[model samples]
Target chain A: MTKKIKETSNSETVVKTEEGKTLDQTVSALSSDAALFNREITQFNVEAETKKQRTATIVKNIFVYTFLTLCAIAAFLPFYWMIISSFKTEAEYRESIPTFFPRTFQWKNYSVVLSQTGAGASFGRILLNTLVVGLLSTTLGLIVIIITAYALARINFKGKNFLFALMLATMMIPGEMYTITNYITVSKWQWNDTFTILIVPFLVSVYYIYLLRNNFMQIPNSLYQAAKVDGLSDMGYLIKVMIPLTAPTLVSISLLKFIGTWNSYIWPRLVNIPDWRMISNWVTSGFTDSAGILGGSTSEALNTLKMAAVCMVSLPLFLLFIFCRKYIMHGVSKSGTKG
Target chain B: MPDKKDTLPQNDVNDVAGVEENVSNDAPQQPQAVKPSLAQKTKQAFADLGKKIKGVFVKDQVALIRDAGNTVITAEMLAGPQLSRKEKFSRFLHSQSGWLFVLPAVLLMCIFTFYPIINAFVGSFKQNYQATTGRFDGFGFENFVRVLKGDTGTGGATFLQCLVNTLVFTLVSVPLSTLIALLISVALNSIKPLQKAYQTVLFLPYLTNSLAMGAVFATFFTIIGTKSNPETPGLVNLALQAFGIAPIDWMGIGSPTWELGAISIPWAKYIVVIVYEVWSGLPFKILILFSALQSVNKQYYDAAKIDGASRSTILWKITAPMISPMISYLLITGIMGGMKQYSAIVGLFGEQMGIDYDMGTMVGYIYRYIEDGYTGYAFAGSLMLFAIIMVITAISNRISKKRVTY
Candidate 1:
């Protein structure tokens, strides 16, 4: 049964037979009769029908634009709120209900967060740390995931199917299953306070590998065959052929990894103590901690400080999205194939 | 091919057993047949087992040694080609060129994912205290028990609360996020111009770190607090005061009110969390669903149109059915994820701000146990949370399977 279906789909006979009809001439001959028979069934009235369909099309266009406008507002509102609320004064912010707009700008909040010296962590240092962790982890993750995915997608070896299934199974296992164990591993390695501890633990992601492999598998076999004929080895084929073809997926995956690491607070919080801090600490821990210490009390300025920190953390991604929207969107489409 | 099953037992076995008669007659064992009745067959089977056992016991030591040696050498010889093939493959695999390509990733994942998972498991079972007293007590189920009962002495909040919170969070957010994403995707898929632009914007939040964004949203809400006695600027209060209504204390827990014009719900904080989760979550749903939606052929829509079907009818009959598989995938994964949702809550609540330290979802309770050095309790909490998430995902999968068209 499968063989029969495969042969039918593989052979282009059905499509070719359909295309050989040469229906264009018949359609043109019936064009004059289209108007006379417009109300009745006719073969050549699709174009006329399309023209008639313009009214609904226009309405749909209007509705879409309006809907898009509302969606864009919804998408951008939280970000805008974060930025705007960061500048609001304590008193102006203390209304019975939250204001859509801020009354007074509290620019000093930014300076206050940034200017503190010998503080547990400053906004500047935190930003630097976040960038470092994001870049390093993403770069490393990309390198590992790309190679592993390429091998799984293209190579044949013992237990290949089993391993792939295992990877999928890993996806089913919640991350919390390994959280405590992972914490212990980091501590044992003396990596708790270091950048290695923060970024190194999430090196190879199964989901990324699965996504990239799925994308790589879609690349035409002819390209690899041609490459092989030209003396390109398997690794060479992956580098020269598959990577270029699946660049969009790689970029998207990398962007997500970068964002995940950049915004990662729990792992950093879990692994690192107050004396040792990352940029996340400055924004999250520092902002929340009233005394700006690791395990200090909650701050009265928690709202403003936290908002300022959020704005700073999210700024890079927001800007990246704004500028490289196309590339990112392309990446998203390619990798997010599984709903 | 020659009816071996019928002839073999009748001819071969009987002939082999009667070989001595043929050998004695000097016929060079041409052939012999001895058909056995059912009782005779059973008796013969028992006699053959006894012969096999007796042969083993009566074997000469020298002949036995020779047979054993021959067997080992012959087996090796038989395996020689396969071994060489394996060696050749490994050499190619470990060659300078290919090895470099594979080595980096192998080392990295081993260091990151594998190492950490093993470490976390070990830590969960151990009774370590502040980098010292690192000892394993084999105190089985103690930590697990303590966490479940909330008797680990880490502020009396039980792990059960964490489980409930996580459940509620997942139950509320997963379906809501999926619905919103479906709606947005359907709306976006129908549009031609600026469809890409709209998708990009909506999907942007999915790419941003939720932890960072959660902190931002918390602050935004905090700043909106009421102005009269406001120590913190929160949005809810500002809006309430502007409308001549009392501003809400968003972060704190509120008293339940049944009377009119009284505070009935913790409207401010609940709304913030929900909105934040929705906002952060929508992008991923849109991304996943949009691609799934795109995979659906326009031919279905065309056929529906030809049948004079309305847009709503087409969506119901065609798009929904086509995307049901993707919906199921998203549903299971989303529910699992929602059950384990933590980073955002941690970011929002921090160490000291929101509702004392005791009020996070189950994951928070687990985190609290870990903080207080209740490894057993934390492990138990984690186990409970894991079981709950697994159960929820399984039930959702079953339900979705029933509803799924494909």
Candidate 2:
């Protein structure tokens, strides 16, 4: 405070205002040198305060950056550990003293895991199952959500509000409630080991439908009326105008749905179909150096092999993130902010 | 529709009675005006066929009805029209076109979602229910009783143990992670240097497979070999050794435990779970809270600064309250997601989830019965899980309702 007062006494520029008016002109017009001196003193104090704030801001920034750096490192440590461990030998991985970096990188670990597909159903087949299921379900789910959203948004119908409310209410219930019964339902239909089972049951995501419906509702009613007047059918208007307008939302919803399918574990694991399990289902199963293929005498649940598999699984998601980051982040932020 | 109307006049040249009727329809209303061209007359006549209101071109005043094509359409048609019961029925059916759009979603939800919920409620009550045969001896409280009493006749994870584990994991991890995320968000919000790079690194974990990440975390805490051959005590133990702490078996059988009547708290194991949860959960919470912080009105900060409020005071009084709603939202979702956690535990401790399912969560317990052929118990367990989630949601809703600033 004393230093501030001292600095207030020091600065005396009497800065010019945006109207091209200076304290010198204003006080000279008033014919009071004392008032000019007081105005300059006040200006000095303001500048001094800002100067103090600048130092404080720099200090605060240093603290913030340091905290952020530590947090970023903590956040990234697991991936680093996973990568380094994947390259380390199994023996080295299990050594009494842990190695920060691999003495020798093991590219063979991935080969061994990939080659030994007999135990956990080959990685290739699992990848195919995932891709097929993801694409089909994402496509089918988007269609269901879009049409449902369109009907609810633009079309006049009885019991529409009630239907929408019912869909929204389902989101409140824990997903586990449906899964146990879905198990029974699917089993009763004997729909095991098929892509249909994976794709069909999860086709209707009420949340995505709700999202798309809201997006659809954003289209002007005048536009619909105009389309009617212009001899364009409802379907034509929807295809040419509504879908294109909501393309960003649709893209995000599709990406999220595909990612959901890629990350789904419980249902696939529950079905217990080795031939048709999704990518996440393959994560928990022990990957070993079987057939003595990696020059190992014994087959054990190798951490290195599991790490290699984890890397393979994670790489595609990273690629997806890099490519579709804008859409993904937009979807997430919209959900957060809107809610 | 347009195509039909476009060529209707030329196609039906032989239908002179219909053409005369079309001309006679507008002749009365437009006696003072010259007749419109034939195509315009046909188009007007076609448009006004189903809609029997005033005909077009009365002294060149009536708007030319262009291509309505025998449908009951007009600008004021939205004001509604008086109709016969059959027309009303047709209109109702026309209105029901929206149902076509919602049909697939409704069907899938009924079969997969709604029916299952009802089935889950009903199936839980059927005593000795056989899913295949659809038979039950009686329907009472038998399944619920068995689940609560831990008397499923299977020797896996008991209900009480799983519940305790779940509560401990969720209650500990969710808040811990939320705090860490808050701190990270605030820091990230403040700094302008390398902000995007820092953000990318922080958000890297968000898209990761939790199970895979869980395995990597497990490797950190895992003791690989026993004393005889003495492999690594893992990276975590190595870190602790630098601090003069002895090695501990984190996920192994010798892991420390505090037991009470079939419920045990393995602190070391809990720490590992909590650590992993905090790490994986941070990205999302950071994403949410950081955005919330960014969107806060800057004027409030300026006001507080002018009032000579300290930095921490500004943070607590202005920024925190501004973002409180988002924080509460994060807590509610974080806790909900934490309770349903299954895959991460599986990744960390393998399929059995730590020596015959001791670390089983609520969802894990449901799966235990589902996989073990105790369908009734699984249903009961799932219902109980549902009830718990509902209660938590209600409580969270009430709390957030009181505290939400905007």
Maximum-DockQ candidate: 2
- Evaluated against the true structure, the overall lDDT of model 2 is 0.80
Interface RMSD for each predicted structure: 4.4, 2.3
What is the two-chain DockQ of model 2? 0.52
Q: Write the per-residue lDDT of candidate 1 for residues B1-406, one digit (tens) a residue.
A: 2231122122233433343232334323333464333333322332433322111111221111112224322111221343467889776665434335445655765665555455555555554333334566663555665565566665644566555555656667778888888888999988777777787678667556566777766665553333455554455455566789765555654522133231122345546667777777788788778888999989988999889999888878899899998888877776766777776776666664256543367677767666666555566566667667677767887898799997
Cα lDDT of model 1 by residue, A50-109, tens digit = 887997888877876887788778888778877876787544544445566787776866
Candidate 1 overall lDDT versus native: 0.63
Residue B3, model 2: Cα distance from true site in angstroms: 39
Query: Which candidate tops lDDT?
Result: 2
Q: What is the per-residue lDDT of model 2 for residues B1-406, given as tens digits with 9 covering 90 to 100?
A: 5433332332233432344455666566664477556445644555555534333332222223323354433323422454789999998899899888888888889999999999999999999988777889899899999999988888877888898889899999999988888888888887777989999999988787878888888988887778334477888888888999988889899899998866788888999988988888888889889988999888998899789899789878888888998899888988888888888898898888898898899999998788877889989999999898989989999999999886
**How much is the lDDT of residue A200 in candidate 1?**
66
lDDT of 1 at A75: 89
